[model samples]
Target: MEVFKQHCQIAEEYHEVKKEIALLEERKKELLAKFEQAEKEKLDAAQLAREYEALAEENRTLKLAQSQCIEQLEKLRIQYQKRQGSS
Candidate 1:
């Protein structure tokens, strides 16, 4: 009878250890999924930053071109006025 009791106790402990292992494996999978998601977000943010910088540079170039055109137009207007006054 004592041997039988000992066998039952061992079996119970074995089952408990198996349950603990299963729980630990499930937690590990959850952590891995979160890590992968964070990496993806980081890459996306970097891409957006690069695109924004390109757009800002284009905006600056366009503004400079516009200023030069306006200056040229003003010079042409002044020349026209001088010719009219001489006539």
Candidate 2:
């Protein structure tokens, strides 16, 4: 009877350990998924940073072009004034 009780106790311990292992495995899977999601977000943020840099460069070029146009307009106005003064 003692031997039978020992066997039953071992079986119960075995089942509890098995259940604990299953729960740990599930937790590990959930953690892995979260890690993957974080990595994806990191990649997306890097891509967005690159795109923003490109936009800033484009804006700089546009501003330079606008300045050049203003300079040309000023030169034309000066020439027109010189003509009127001569006439």
Candidate 3:
């Protein structure tokens, strides 16, 4: 009877260890998936930053061109007014 009780206890302990191992394996898989997702997001963020920088440079160029055009138009308007006043 003593040996039988010992055998049953050992079996129960074995089953508990297996259950714990299975739970740990599931948690490890979940963590790995999260790590992969984080890496993908990092890559996407870097790409967006590059695109934003390109667009910002283009906007600066356009603003400079617009300022130049306005300066030229102002000069033309002043010349026309002077001509009209002289005539």
Best by TM-score: 2
Please list the C-alpha lDDT of all candidates, in the order they appear: 0.97, 1.00, 1.00
lDDT of 2 by residue, 7-46 (tens): 9999999999999999999999999999999999999999
Q: Tell me the number of clashing residue pairs for each predicted model.
A: 0, 0, 0
Compare candidates 1 and 2 on lDDT and give the better one: 2
> Once model 1 is optimally superposed onto the true structure by TM-score, how far is the C-alpha of residue 25 displaced, in angstroms?
1.4
Expressed as tens digits, the lDDT of each residue in 1-87 for candidate 3 is 999999999999999999999999999999999999999999999999999999999999999999999999999999999999999
Of candidate 2, the 10-residue stretch with the lowest lDDT total is 1-10
RMSD of each: 2.1, 1.7, 2.6
What's model 1's TM-score? Answer: 0.77
Query: In candidate 1, which residue pairs get closer than 3 Å at backbone N, Cα or C atoms, i.e. clash?
Result: none
Query: What does the lDDT read for residue 67 in candidate 1?
Result: 100
Candidate 2 or 1, higher TM-score: 2
How well is each residue in 1-87 modelled by candidate 1, as lDDT tens digits?
999999999999999999999999999999999999999999999999999999999999999999999999999999999999999
